[model samples]
Target: MACVTGKNSKPKSMSKAKEWTVEVENLFRFQQAGYRDELEYIQVKQGALIERWPDTGYVKKLQRRDDTFFYYSRKRECQDFEVHKVKVYAY
Candidate 1:
């Protein structure tokens, strides 16, 4: 006979969270909050975060595993999720 698991099994770990989506605007917010990184910069004209291309310094550092990423302390439920919009001016 094969063993079966019960409903009271231990909760799954967050370790399976390998893929992450890094939003450029959030990085910009982090930078404004004093998190500095050459790869993370606010374009004077665009007012948007520069992730790669046209922004070589910071991108290079990111390639070397030297980038600074930020995260929220608490997890939110689907119903509690909110959408934030940022506007950037371009040349």
Candidate 2:
């Protein structure tokens, strides 16, 4: 048998600045293979890279295009992909 408690747990809150930064990241979005996603940006500040996930405002539009060669290595090059822009979230 188990007993129930009536107390509620409190959730931790972050600073407003952190919340705003997160919102901005959510605004930057991208699409791949018909799937919409976000690409983040990292800024180097005070020896640390400020990282966030992008939202929807980044990509103007995504259009279906024929397959193009991203890169070619003489042997087994299909495992990796190429991205035009990327951010470093961690060191």
Off by over 4 Å in 1: 1-21, 25-82
lDDT of each: 0.29, 0.24
What digit string (tens of lDDT, one per residue) describes model 2 on residues 1-91? Answer: 0122323322233121122222222222222322222221111111222232233223333222342212212232112132222121211
Best by TM-score: 1
Model 1, position 62: C-alpha lDDT score: 22
- lDDT (10s digit) by residue, model 1, range 1-91: 0122542233232121122223333333343444332222332222344344333222311222244553332222112122122222211
Which regions of candidate 2 are displaced past 4 Å?
A: 1-29, 33-57, 66-91
Candidate 1 local accuracy as lDDT? Answer: 0.29
Clashing pairs in 1: 38-58, 39-58
- Find the 10 residues in a row with the least total lDDT in model 2: 38-47
